[model samples]
Target: MADFNPGRDEVEDVAAMKREGDLSRFLRQQIRDGQARRDKPTAAPKPAPPPGYRPGAWPSGTSPPGPLPDRGADWDRALDRYRNGEGSDRDPCHCGACDTPDNNQTEEN
Candidate 1:
């Protein structure tokens, strides 16, 4: 009868390697590799922004879109009423567009 070897064809099990202290050695090697990677300098730092660079500023020579169309007299009156404490929740909006009737209503014959 042949002598029985615990390892099959010279391949040792993980538990056997741990008992033999190889696990700690491998772990230390991995830790050293990680530390070396972190200590290595990264690529060149990003260039600093130009002097007086204002974040969120529109680029030079570009202006915001033209001012909104004037709100006109009706809007002014509404705003004035509100400021003078004459406006109330029940007051109808005078936006003009809403004052027009929808297509569903027809003039009575």
Candidate 2:
């Protein structure tokens, strides 16, 4: 079993590092190592900006938001039939064979 000392002050060279300068230096180093991190600073991560990158700024190769489509079928009679429940009771067709190529392409086999 490993030796475990619960209340032991496990400071390395505790007598030498008693004053403010040593503690301050140690804390500053720890904070720096935790934050901007001393790794090789390469290209900024995608979806995450680097240390000094600004928001609302687009990258090198991105197009602006293009015009959105005016979606949904706007036919009056077909929409009116669906709305008024006139076309509600018809059973769904599930036959494998079809007469029209367009219908075959659209409808399932």
Candidate 3:
């Protein structure tokens, strides 16, 4: 078995390697390689966002598709109540979509 001595200062050699050698470059290259292997960009990419997630999917950029279907009458009424502050004091539908079809930028015939 090889004898090891702690007082001889093995860390000095490591410090020398870190400073003069390409050890840092070698370590960075290894890390980049490992990441490339893990990522494997050549593999299939994730599916694009759904129709609802697309840009301008709704009148408001922030509005998400609601649990309520696009029943225009109910949407209008809800929007009216929300505008008048007749609904909950919290203003739940203030996101501008009214959780249904848009009341903004619409005309009733």
Candidate 4:
């Protein structure tokens, strides 16, 4: 009768090779061969800027050099223009309650 060889024998051989440090030596030799095959040292790529980096301003998490300017007067001027009917005909009135065409007419006319 022919002898039956189980799959465990192959696994046992691998374990024995690993225990004897043969596997590590084989891996080291493969790495050395790969390194020798390369002709040039590859330059590492430059790291990209962080997500919070602004072109002309400071990065996120840091405060600006001075206090921010008050924009209340700007808002008041815009509201005054809107009330004076300075917006284009296509633009809706500032008041949300009405959509009449007369709302777009300027008082100067």
TM-score of each: 0.28, 0.23, 0.23, 0.26
- Which 10 residues in a row give candidate 3 its minimum summed lDDT? 96-105
Better of 2 and 3 by lDDT: 3
lDDT of 4 by residue, 54-80 (tens): 788877778777987999999998988
Q: lDDT at 62 for candidate 3?
A: 61
What 10-residue stretch in candidate 1 is worst by lDDT? 95-104
Ranking by lDDT: 4, 1, 3, 2
Looking at model 1, how many pairs of residues clash? 0
lDDT of 1 at 61: 72
Report lDDT per candidate.
0.65, 0.55, 0.65, 0.74
Ranking by TM-score: 1, 4, 2, 3
Which residue pairs in candidate 1 have backbone atoms (N, alpha carbon, C) closer than 3 angstroms, thus clashing?
none
Candidate 2 stretches greater than 4 Å from native: 1-56, 72-89, 94-109
Which of 1 and 3 is the better model by TM-score? 1
Candidate 2 global CA lDDT score: 0.55
lDDT of 1 by residue, 1-109 (tens): 6785656734565576688979888769979998988866679988998876788997777878998888798899888876543433333453332333432235557
lDDT of 3 by residue, 1-109 (tens): 6786645465676576688986788679979998888945486787897656646456545667569676999989988876755544343565443544343335569
Clashing pairs in 2: none
